[model samples]
Target: MTLEATDVSHGYGNETVFDGVSLSVSTGEVVAIIGPSGVGKSTLLRLLALFDAPDRGTISYDGEDVWRQPEGRRLEHRRRIGMVFQDASLFDASVRRNAAYGLRVRQSWPERIRHGFAQLVGEQNGTGDAVEALETVGLADKVDQDADSLSGGEAQRVAFARALAYDPEILLLDEPTSDLDPRNTAVIEDAVLQARDRGIGVVVATHDMHQARRVADRTAVLLGDEILEVDRTERVFDDPRDDRTRQFIDGELIY
Candidate 1:
């Protein structure tokens, strides 16, 4: 599967955020969007996640324009994609419950009732895929703890686990580890690579250049309200086609 944005442009009223942006990510590939803060990276991810419509272009999944589809079809497309935001907006519930939230909401009401009854009777813990996802984020032991009591980094890990539990075909992350410590950041990066190995298309919008180099198969540079370059990770770092890309990679370009 491929998730693509073609000639995509967006803005807030009269102020344009980005224009004429085109990018694609295929299954089993990781694409990184790198830019300084406020460069519209988050906005681009939102468009790719099907959370918002592009003002002047199309977002396509498998060659079909997503926004042009009927609401039911668009909804099905959204169900196949998962997004993790910068903030870990977890509910005031147990870690296990939070991790399984995505999957739970997608279930039929009757199924949810059955599961609830099973949990009540001790027939199941209701962990299901949440256990594996939490383990991937190194939080398997914290499954029964209150999500509200976790540290910031732990909370973010829970958020990533929640997204992973649904087994999305496309995963979009927006600066998921910006505030995490090195150890926690490494865990998240490993989970990302695992997702890629499972043939999931991953697009990560990150300010961490080192993280991009470590995890992305392809890197794209967004600057001056446009995509300046997109190429293999090593080539983008060592031999950027655009001087601006070189400047950005060398930390010489100031936002």
Candidate 2:
């Protein structure tokens, strides 16, 4: 599934954050929307996630305009495009239940239900195929812990695991590692790459340029409330094409 935002103008009341902002993300690719705090990076992600509709613009999935679709269609669209918030909040339930939250079924046999996560990550001991998922993000040991009991980083991993568990085609990340230490950040970074390997297109809104350069294939630099530059990670870091983008990287207020 591909996400395309075209001429997307959005804001609340008199303040317009973005205007004529457009970008595209393809499967197996990771696009990082980078900018300073409170610059509408998260707002743009919300628009792409279909959580909010733009005041004047359109969002499309594979060329089909989503804003034009009905509410039911929008729900289905969201199901296919799973979202991972900064603080990956798992329910107050068990780890197994939390991971299997995406796989919940009303008619599924109760006995076979818990087996969903087990099936995804085989051979219990938290050492099965699901182990691979956890191991990918260095969270293999906390598989049995309750969601609320986990640390910030661990909860985020569980959230990623849950998203993978859902097997969505598109992954939307909003400041996914704003709280992690360097060690934990690397682990989650690997997990993001794993998602790309699985052919899931990822759009991440982040403040960490280092992480963006490390994980993103393409970087979309948002400035002046619009995408100022969209290019390869290396090129973007080495040379930003926009004045506002350069100012952002240098930590200088554009005012």
- Indicate which candidate wins on lDDT: 1
70: Cα error in model 2, Å: 2.2
Runs of candidate 1 with Cα error greater than 4 angstroms are: 120-126
Residues 111-212 of candidate 1 have per-residue lDDT tens digits of 999989987786655567998999999999999899998999999999999999999999999999999999889999999999999999999999899999
Measured by C-alpha RMSD in angstroms, how accurate is candidate 2? 4.0
- Candidate 2 residue-pair clash tally: 5
lDDT of 2 by residue, 201-231 (tens): 9998999988898899999998777788899
Global fold similarity of model 1 (TM-score): 0.96
- Alpha-carbon shift of residue 183 in model 2 (angstroms): 1.2
Q: How does residue 84 of candidate 2 score in lDDT?
A: 85
Model 2 residue 25 distance off true place after TM-score fit, in angstroms: 0.6
